[model samples]
Each structure stands twice: as C-alpha cells, then as structure tokens.
Target: MSDNFSRPQHTAPLTPILQLVNSAPIVLVAFFAIGLSWWFLLIGVIFLVVGGFGYWASWQRRFFWLNEEGELEARSGILFRRSRQLRISRLQSVDILRPPVARLLGYSSLKIEVAGSGDSRVILSYLSVGKAQELRSEILALAKDERTSTQSAEPADHWKWQVPNGRLVASLVLTTSTYFLIIGAVASVAFALVEPGSGLVTLALAVGGSTISLIAGITSLFNFSVGRNDRGIAISHGLFTTAHYTVSPIRIQAICVVQPIAWRPFGWYQVAINVAGADQSSKKSGPRVLIPVVHEDALPELFHELLPSWNLEIEDEWLASAATSRWRFPWQAARLAVSLTSDLFVVRSGALTRRLSAAPHERIQSIRITQGPWERKLGISSLHADSVPGPVRLRGRGLASSVAVHTALAELDRMFTARKSRKSEQW
Candidate 1:
C-alpha cells in the first residue's frame, strides 16, 4: 500500500469561475432582498467577481496530496493558516460534480463526504473532469484495499443501468415532488398578480421558493446512471450539475423502492438506500438514490446487483393488496403486503405512492407486533421489524389474522437464529 502514484496537487485552475457560477443565484437573491438598484447591483457584481477570485486564490493554497502517514491532507488559509488530514480508510464517499458551465470550462468539483459530524465534507473545486475521476479512483482504491480502475472503456464484470431520457422526463413529471413544486409556483404567481396585498405577497414569496425545487428536479434527472462492481455501487447523474457518487454495497443497511401514483401505471420505480455513513437529514438533499427510475422488467437483475442476499423473488400473492382489510384502516392498510425470504423481509404498502421496503436479516435489530381494538376483534395485526434510520422501514399492516402474524414472527425469529448460527452465510 505504498503511495507511489502521482496525485493531484491543488484544486483545478478554474476554481474561481466555478465558485462564481454556483454563487450567482445566492448573490442575486441577496441583491433582490437588499433592494439594490441596477447601478448598485453592477458594483456588487464587480465586487463578487473580485471576492470569488480572492476566495479561490486563498483556497487553492491548500494543497491536497498523500502525506507521509498515508492520509489525505490539506494545508490552507492566507492570514490565519489551517491544515486538515483525513484517513484514507475512513473516507465514506468521493463524488465528482460538474455543473454544465463547469463542464464547458473543462472543470468539476470533488466532494469528499465522510461520516460523524454534520456537513463534514472536503471540497476541491475546478478539477478537470479527467483529473477528478483519476483522483477519485486512486483515493477509493486505497480506501477499499484494491487497485485503481483500468484505463479500459468500461469496468469489467459489472452491472450498469442507463436511464433513458424519455424515462427520466416521465419519472420527473409523474413524480409528486415535481408537480408539488409546479403547483406551488403557479399558485404563487396567481396570488402575486391577482391579489396585491402585502400579506399575500409574503405567502407568494414563500411559495415562489418552489421555483428552485422545480429547477433542481429537472437538472437532477439528467443522464442518471447506476452500476455495481466488486468495489462498490456507483451512481452518476445530473445534466446541469452532473455528480458521481460511489458507496460500498456491503454498507447498505436498508432500501425503499417507491412507485408514485402516476408512475405506478407504467411500473416505474425509484430505489433509495441508506448506506452505513450516509446522512439521513433530508431525503431530497442527500445523494442516496440507488436507481432513479427503472421499469419492472429490470428489477430482478437490478435487485441482485444492489442487494444480492435480498434478491428474494416475490410472487404475485405476496404483493397482495389486502382488499378485505380495507374496512380496518381504509386505504392506508388496504394495500398491505408482506413476505419473508431466507435472507430478506419485504413490506409493501401505501395507497397513492406504493412503497416496497426491504431489509436484510443481518441488519434487522428488533421486531414487534401490535393490534388495535378493531384489528384485535378481527383477529388481525401489524408487524414491524425496526432497524437503523434511513429510507427503509419494515412494517406490514392489516395482517389477515393474529395467528398468521405470530407464525410470521416465529418464522422470523427462527430464520434469524439460524442465520446467526451460520453467521458467515448471512447477508
């Protein structure tokens, strides 16, 4: 594990330009808030340019390279100097994000996302795309106890998924999130124009914020790609701001496969996972998307690729919408479905947005069963297998009978006990 390879010395040369491009929206908002006149804004723009360059110049002084102890180190600051070091083995995720403009400028930003403290990320901006990719491969290799990727056209022995443009657009449109923003934006405009009151204007201003979400959703959906190899699972997407995120699949704790109301008809599903070191604060913000959208036909192989142990073929009966239990919990528990395979337990529920949650047995920390008065009277209950936080929740409501629920729980306990006995064989 010698640090023999030549590594990147500093941030890309166009760091200032990339920073300015990313900061433009914030700068504009600040100007609008301050009621800056056109001439004043012009002056502010000049200052912004100068300040961006100054920040970049100061930032680049922090050289990034392998230190003697085999750690990624950075030395920075102009007036009050600062230095930081991150253990190569402790790195959680390495990402390359390229805004459209940055790509045109032949530059991208590298995000080194790690665990523990909130927002503890190391960012290197303006790296040439090739250089960024190279650095990422090298760092990831060192961290994962492997060699860097070959210079071949593609990685060998891997599962790669390409999301078609049509599917991406369809998923984005069909996604409730996209329309929620659009509706908010439309309502904001309507209010601002139709009712000219200060209070209404404030509300409109609040709703106007959805404009950014709409734009982000559109930009985020572009060129989404997912794949898995011996090293880990890799996800790269975005057009306006392309990003490459990689995580070791072994670290994946839970998975949530979602089919929105509109996309359900087409059988389009989005799979999101919670990995060992991922931050779970906001679903939309984090880079936790496993597969943005894929049709049903592709799921068998996709599931195996991402979670091999949990590749439990769910039969149609297991996906049963518990129509008979509709009276118990209305639409909420109407579509309840649950299945347990040797390695994985899956629960599918939700009316408007059909959700399929899967968690490997090794990750299941606890299990519980509950019944309400009416459910008890009906000799039915709900089952829950709780695990660490993320998108995955294993809960099946409206079981057909209490005896069946107990049988399932007993089976779960037996399977878990057997798996524990054969620890090496478990997922």
Candidate 2:
C-alpha cells in the first residue's frame, strides 16, 4: 500500500450521507411545523435540498495530509478556509469512533487530541473502516518518531478487565438518578390526584428527562472493556457509537476510584482517570472511564498494569480530619482522610459515595492550604493538591492547621524531587 499521505486526501464518498443524516433533526422540525401552515412543507423540502448540497460542498473542500515537517495538517470550510496543524510531539491521544450510522455504512472517524490545545480537537470524519485503522496506526507511529508506512498486525493485548452487559445495565438502573426518578414519579402521581393539570406536566417532565439520561448512560457504557497492548492502555465501549481509545500511561495525571453506597453490597467500583488534554468541563469530553464497573478485588492488578510506576497501596497511617470538623461536615468528617506514599498522594472522602483519589508526585501541579472563617475558628484547615482538570480531585478537608501546613510543605518537596528524577529519565 502506498504511504504517500503527503498528498491531501478527502473523506470517504459516503460522507455526505452521514452529514445529511446529522441534519435530519432540522428537517423533522420543519415537518412538524407543516401542521401550522402548508408553506412549512414546501420550506422543509427546500431546506433538505439546500442542506444536502451544502454537505456535499463541505465534504469536497475538507482535506487532510502530512506536511514536510511531519505534522498532521487539515483544511476545511467552503467560503472561509480553516486550517489546522497537529504537532506529533504534542499528541495526547488518538481515538477511533464509529457511530451507529457510520458503523452501518462501514465507516469510522478519527478523533485526534493534542496537549495544551483547548477546544481544538481535530476530527477526520467518514473514512473507510480499513483506511481509518491504517491512518490511526500511521499517526501513532509518527508520533512515536517511527517512520513506517505498511500497516502492522494488531498487537496481542492481554485483556485485563471487562464489565458484563448485565452488570452495566443494572449499575445504570441502580444509580442515585434512578432513585430520584422513582421519587419524582411517585410524587407526580400523587400530585396529579390532587391537581390534575400541573401534576401531569410534572410527571411528563420527570419521566422524559430521567428516561433520556438512563438511555444515554446505557449506550455510553455498554460493552465496556479495558486491556493492555504494546502502545498503552486500550479502552473500548459504547452501544450505538463504539469508541476505541489508546491512552499512554505517561499522559495520565490522576486516578479516582468511586464506590456508591448502593454498589457497596456488590463490592463494585468505578474507576476514572484524569488525562492531559482531555476537556474536563464538558460532560461529552470529561474524564475517561478506565473501568465502568469492576470488583474491588480486581483493583490491585488493574492499578499495577495501569500505573506501573506508582505504589498503589494505601498507607495505614492516614491524616484524619480534626475533631471540630464535625461542625461543618457532620456525617462526612469521620470518613475524611489523606495519606502520602513514596510515589503517590492520596485523598479519601465522601460518605454515601466513597471516593479515593490518587495522583503521582510528579503530576501534582500545585499544593494549597486553605482556611475559612469557620475553619479558622475551629483550628482546622484544608489541603489540596492541584492537577489537570478531571474526575480525580486531591483534597483533604478538616485537617488541623498545623498538620495541613506541615503536610503541604512535605508534598511540595516530594513533588520537586519526583519531577527532577522524571526529567533525568528518557522517554
């Protein structure tokens, strides 16, 4: 196969179909408006034709290729040309996504993320399955400074963890949201008996929102699996839109393990990670789920494989919250604890949903000690270790002021030492 990606390449011929499908929602609205006026039907027809033509034009203008400097370059837009360049050195992750429609048509998309680039994700859409896979491998190879053109055989990955379809469905159904949904539903029914008009509206809204949330959760987490390959940790999941993510261990900043009260009986936990360059604010691009659901016993092995460099064990001597902290966090103060290992800083908190957040020493961005008016009166302070935005949050509340200060200084020293050592090692 020719490795001549230097020449600009267009998306698959079927891209217009996918684009049109995406625009169908607008057409649907137009159809609904037809009841208001027959002119709406004519308008809908015109919109569909114009949208289809625009999609074709946009598809024709979009192009991607490798430049002389080895950076991935893309250009798109019809009137105002928009150009993007992705430096291989700053590459964070390369993911393959196949939405329901694209999968049905044997097509896929590549989502390329770069470090330190906010909201600048580059997506190469509507590529043939084979072509997308080949391009993905090529990009990964180039990012690693390996000059190769031929497609390599898939690496033999040792499957580490998998979530059963049954467990996944059950987990989604058993969440706090489900509880709220049930309560709202029952309340709405009661209200309807008292005031029929308002009650019906409340019931409809509650059911509609909860149903959508449940369906989205199920679709996103269905068939979740994690494994280790030659490149890095591989995560695959989704029902309608399957996504395969390749995350390098070095890019991981922090890890969080959460166990909801309801899931405690089953000894199930959910693990999420904070990775560099991932959009933390957006739900659609938040922390990557390392494992949607897993038994507690499997955690040691999972951590060992995912974070080979860090010591995963929690130390027995943990810094507990101050006695006076009960004034602020009555129920949770007893559960608040923080610990530091040779290689990791760990924080534990939460009552109903127990959370364990850990970050490697080198990954800690900053250390802060905070004391509010109430905390000051109670002689308590909070310590926080900042990291890249994600699910893993390193914070220990309700610590003795003296203890918080000492721990913060110690952590700063450890962070510097870890960073210095890391700099000495070659990638």
| Number of the top-ranking candidate, with lDDT as the measure | 2
Residue 64, candidate 1: Cα error in Å is: 1.5
User: How many clashes does the backbone of model 2 have?
Assistant: 0
Residue clash pairs of candidate 2: none
lDDT of 2 at 120: 62
Candidate 1 residue spans exceeding 4 A from truth: 1-8, 20-42, 45-53, 115-120, 146-157, 177-215, 282-286, 314-325, 332-334, 370-381, 400-427
lDDT of 1 at 217: 75
Residue by residue across 373-410, what tens digits does model 2's lDDT show?
99999999999999998777889999999989998999
**TM-score for each prediction?**
0.77, 0.88
Model 1 / residue 270 / CA error / Å: 3.1
lDDT of 1 at 49: 75
The weakest ten consecutive residues by lDDT in model 2 span 146-155
